[model samples]
Target: MSTVIRKYEPYNRFKGYLVENNIKQREVAEVVGLSVSQLNQKLNGTRGDFSATEIRLICKAYNISPLDYFFYD
Candidate 1:
């Protein structure tokens, strides 16, 4: 079987990050200043996108660099 090399998908990576960190969606929603329902919409691609400030806030909340965690593939 050929191995599948997946290209980076931002939302998918974010979801994986939540899982890997054992974090609740509500917790992340709080970090990003979004309501749980709003976060769900964004994560599911129904909403537009996360603002830069929101992303920065989330990275800061987790004590991570946005460039390292988010901007990278």
Candidate 2:
């Protein structure tokens, strides 16, 4: 039996989206309906996971798709 290992791709678009939108972290928090500290935790990689509802809220707030955040080239 062979164990297949895949490289882990972190969810990194939260910051990118903020940058592209010219939004500050505080501003992103407001737009995404999250607390500043919570958003910071996510951006700083302290939070290990984002709920599906959180993902949807972010996508809806930013007018993007979940695929846009999670997919890689």
Candidate 3:
């Protein structure tokens, strides 16, 4: 049997979206129900990744599709 590994980097996509859309980190954190500090930690790779629920909230708040994070470059 063989195992395959993939690099999943949604954080970078999220950051790019923020920059492109001119959305502030604090605004995203508030919409996703996280403290700005916690959001920063996740964005900076110091804390755990965003949960499925959090991702959904972010997409909903920003009117974006979750697929944008997973499928696009």
Candidate 4:
């Protein structure tokens, strides 16, 4: 049997996007209809993953593609 190792940090990409674009977490939560605490939980990996609607709203607000949020090198 063989094991595969991956070095992907899922949420970091989103965090990086926010930092790069100067987007505030509070504003994003408001626009996405999430509570600031909820957004923090999601971003901090304490809560579950973002819903599809939330993802769409974040992308829309930042004028970014979903790909940018998920996969940035």
Candidate 5:
């Protein structure tokens, strides 16, 4: 069975936050413990799959609650 990925707007929001903070994408990748290329791919929508650990890391990095990043309709 195929897994359905829910829409998560926080990725864009998070990117904006990073830019607003003058945080480089590579810096964010290092801070979030993700590879720079991997993070770039994710940001570009070339990768839509992320692990639970990644989600937690992202939330931690952005200081946003996990629940705030996601919703299902």
Candidate 6:
């Protein structure tokens, strides 16, 4: 079998959380006060890091710890 690789490994855990929770990408973008494309760019590592406030808002909206999504092994 061929191995498939993801473009955004750093956010893989977060992506899983979103999927498991049935959270939509547009909702996340709204919560973070960003456009969907902008959010995608950030998640894809094409853009730089998210601002502190953006992270806080996302965590608050989802009631998730940053470590669970941002900091990964």
Error of 5 at 5 (Å): 16
Per-model TM values vs. the true structure: 0.72, 0.65, 0.75, 0.75, 0.61, 0.80
**Structure candidate 1, residue pairs in collision:** none
State the number of backbone clashes in model 4: 0
Residues 14-71, candidate 6, lDDT per residue (tens digit)? 7788889999889999998899998877776667667889989999999999988887
Off by over 4 Å in 1: 1-10
Candidate 4's C-alpha runs over 4 A off are 1-10, 71-73
Query: Which wins on lDDT, candidate 1 or candidate 5?
Result: 1
Measured with C-alpha atoms, the lDDT of residue 12 in candidate 4 is 81
Give me candidate 5's TM-score against the actual structure.
0.61
User: Which tens-of-lDDT digit does each residue in 14-34 have in candidate 2?
Assistant: 577777779787876786678
Which residue pairs in candidate 5 have backbone atoms (N, alpha carbon, C) closer than 3 angstroms, thus clashing? Answer: none
Candidate 5, residues 1-73, lDDT tens digits: the string is 9864544333665566667889798876886678999887676556665567877887777787766543223
Candidate 4 structure quality by residue, lDDT tens digits, 1-73? 8753323334788888789879888898999888999887777766777888888888887788988675446
Determine which window of 10 residues in candidate 2 has minimal summed lDDT.
3-12
Candidates 4 and 5: which is better by TM-score? Answer: 4
List the candidates ranked by lDDT, beginning with the highest.
6, 3, 4, 1, 2, 5
Q: Compute the lDDT of residue 19 as modeled in candidate 4.
A: 92
Superior candidate under lDDT, 1 versus 6: 6
Clashing pairs in 2: none
Q: Which candidate would rank higher by lDDT, 2 or 5?
A: 2
Using lDDT as the measure, which candidate wins?
6
On TM-score, the candidate that comes out on top is 6
* Model 2 lDDT at residue 44: 64
